[model samples]
Target: MAVRPDPIPAAQAAGTSLEEELAAVAASSLDQLRPRFRALFRVPVPDCLSRDMVARLIVHRLQEQRLGKLDRSLAEQVDRLGRGQESRRRFKAGTVLVREHDGVMHEVMVVPDGFLWNGGTFASLSIIAKRITGTSWNGPRFFGLRPVLKKHAPEAAVVVDDADA
Candidate 1:
C-alpha cells in the first residue's frame, strides 16, 4: 500500500517504476488495497476514472464498504440495493437510457412498493438488470437478489414531474 511517489531521481531515475509498485497493489484485491492506494495516491474518488482498472478499484472499494465481509450473500444484496437507487436516480424518466449502441426509450414508474416498474408495456426488464448489476439475465433474478424494497422507497427520489405531488 505504500505508494512511493515517483521516487526521488537518485532512488530510481534509472529503474524502479510506478508500474512495479502498482503490481504490488494489484496483488491484493482492490477492496483490500484501496485505502493504501487512496492514501498513497492522495486522490479524491467518485470522479471519472478510466475503465476496467478503475472498475476493479471501485469493486474493491465496494467490497470494503459492506458491513459483513464474510457474508457474500448479504454483500451482494446491499450492492444491488445501492446500485438500484443509483440507477433510478441516474436514469429517471426523460433521462436517456443508452446501452453500448442501442437506445431504449424511457418510461419509468416508481410504484408504491418501491419497485421501479418500467413504464412502457414492452419495456425490457433486462434494462433494469443490466443497469443495476452490469449483467442481463432473464426473469426476476435481479429483483430476487435486490434488497427488500420498502413501500415508500427512494428517500431521495428525484421526481421529474409534479403530477404525483
Candidate 2:
C-alpha cells in the first residue's frame, strides 16, 4: 500500500496556526468554496453534501484533538444513532426481543455473542428474520427495533397475522 501524505499538515503552512486555519474554515461558506477545500486537502469536496457537513467534519476533528475522544458509551450511542438506532436499548444477557408472526409471538433472548430463539443460538437477527418470514428483510426493521424514516409510520407495516382472531 502506498503511503498517503497528510492532507493538511500544521507544520507545512507557516503563516496561520491550526486554530487560526480552523477558525477561517468555520467561518467560510462550505457550499461556495469547492476549490478552497480541494486546494487545502488535495481532495475534492463532494458536491452532493452541504457546506455545513464539510465544516462540521473539520471542526469535529479539531475539537476531538483538543478534547480527546468521547467516552466509549457515548461513542457507542453516537454510532448507534448514526446507524439508524437499531436495538437502542442495549440488551443485556437475558433481555428478550419479542415479535408476533402468523399468530405466535417468537421470543429471542439476547445472548453474549448472539441471540437465542427456539433453543437455537443465531449470529444475527437477520438470520432469525429470514427464518420467521421466509423472505428477505432488514432484520432490525422486521423486528420493529429500528426507527422508520419515511413518511409512513412503523405501525403501518402489513402483517398477515391471523392470530388476531
Candidate 3:
C-alpha cells in the first residue's frame, strides 16, 4: 500500500543541473580572472559567452593551425567543465536562447551573448560539434560555420509522378 511519487515537472527536471554547473563555472572563472581582465581591458566583464561564440572561436582556430596534443588536452578540459544545451533552433525572430534555472527565459539577446548572427538562421550541427570539442574546422569560412542541416537532394534524376497534380 505505498503511494507512488509524482513525476517531476518537465521544466524542473530538464537542464537545471547544467544551468547550476554553468553558473558555478562562470562565477569561478570570473573570480579567478577578475583582476587580470580588469587590467587588460577597459570594458566591463561579460556575464557569459554564448555556446555558438565559443564554438566559432575554437573551430576557426583549429582550422588555421595545427593544434596537435595541446589543443586536444584543453578541449578535453572544456568539454568536462562546460555545460550547455544539446540543441538549438533559430526562429523567425526573438527566440530565447538560454532559460533560467527557475524556468524563465532570460531577456538577453543571443548576439550580445556571442552568437554571430540573428535573422533566425538555423546553424549546422557540424559547427556545433566542432565547438564542443574545441577543435577548429578547416573550411573557407572564417568560423567554420556551415548552413543549417537539411535533407540531402536525391542523387538520381527527377522522376515525374503527377498523380496528385
Identify the candidate with maximal lDDT.
Answer: 2
lDDT of 2 by residue, 1-165 (tens): 975433443424667566876776666665434555565457888777687888776666656666688999889888988998653655567766777787778888778889888989998889998999898867777777676676753342233332223
Using alpha carbons, what is the TM-score of model 3?
A: 0.15
Worst-scoring 10-residue span by lDDT in model 3: 153-162
Quality of model 2 by C-alpha lDDT: 0.68
Which has the better lDDT: candidate 1, or candidate 3?
1
Best-to-worst ranking by TM-score: 2, 1, 3
- State the C-alpha lDDT per candidate: 0.42, 0.68, 0.35
**Residue 146, model 1, lDDT:** 32
Which structure among the candidates has the greatest TM-score?
2
TM-score of 2: 0.43
Report the error of model 2 at residue 114, Å: 0.5
Candidate 1 collision pairs: 31-60
Better of 1 and 2 by lDDT: 2
lDDT (tens digit, per residue) of candidate 1 on 1-165 = 875444212212366455544454445543444455465346743445543475466445434543225577666667878876432232234322222213333333434333354433325545665664465554232333234355642122123542322
Which ten contiguous residues of candidate 2 have the minimum total lDDT?
156-165
